[model samples]
Target: MFIRIVKMSFHEEKIPLFLDNFHSVKNDIRNFPGNNFLELYQDKNNPSIFFTYSVWNEESDLETYRNSDLFKSVWAYTKAFFNDKPQAWSVDKLESLP
Candidate 1:
């Protein structure tokens, strides 16, 4: 399995728009073929910053999603709300401590 994390810094003024776009994002991924799980997080100290935690069957599944039209549309809208470039990382799921 692959774990993907994305950290985004949103513009204060664009929070509403970003929230609307996130609905679409969530719906899209929820129905995707290889998505395993997803979670959204926010920093208590920084409301404008958010993180997405998602698991996929493989890196190729993520790549396919990223290259899909839905991602393009979502990303184009999403990019406008960022205070800084979004950062992302992918890793192999090695062990679960629990």
Candidate 2:
């Protein structure tokens, strides 16, 4: 599986709106075909900075999601609140330790 990580920074006042939207659609994203996991993380030093960590069965699965209506809608809403351009990366797992 490949891991997808996205870092986003929102306008301070818009964080609540972004979070509410996330909560409303997170389940749909997590259950999407070929998705294995989904999680969200906030930076300790900056409340407006957040990260989305997800796992996909393959890169094509990620591409499919990106082209879906769900992604388009969510991205449209989320991007409106951005303080900066979002950054994303897809990487292979090196190791995992319990």
Candidate 3:
């Protein structure tokens, strides 16, 4: 499995708009094919900064999602609220320590 992390910096005033949009589509994202999990996180120091942490079965799965209409729709609206360019990473698990 692999992990996809996206760090987004939103316009402070647009945070609520982002949240509302997320609320409406998060479920569809979580249920997307090849998605293992989905999570949203906010920076304690900066409410305008948020992260999306998700796990996918493989990199190709992530690519597939990125190419889908769902992503196009969600991202189109989501990016309009960004204060800065979003950063993202796709990584494989090296190890897990319990």
**Ordered list by lDDT, greatest first:** 2, 3, 1
TM-score of 2: 0.99
Could you tell me the TM-score of candidate 1? 0.92
Q: Alpha carbon lDDT of residue 36, candidate 1?
A: 89
Weakest lDDT window of 10 consecutive positions for candidate 2: 86-95
Local distance difference test, per candidate? 0.88, 0.97, 0.95
Please tell me which model should have the higher TM-score, number 1 or number 2: 2
Identify the leading candidate in terms of lDDT.
2
Which portions of model 1 miss their true places by more than 4 Å? Answer: none
**Model 2 lDDT tens row, 1-98:** 97999999999999999999999999999999989999999999999999999999999999999999999999999999999999999999999999
Better of 1 and 3 by lDDT: 3
Residue lDDT tens for model 1, 1-98: 88999999999999889887787679688678788898889889999999999999989998998998988888888898899989998877678896
Candidate 3 structure lDDT: 0.95
TM-score of each: 0.92, 0.99, 0.95
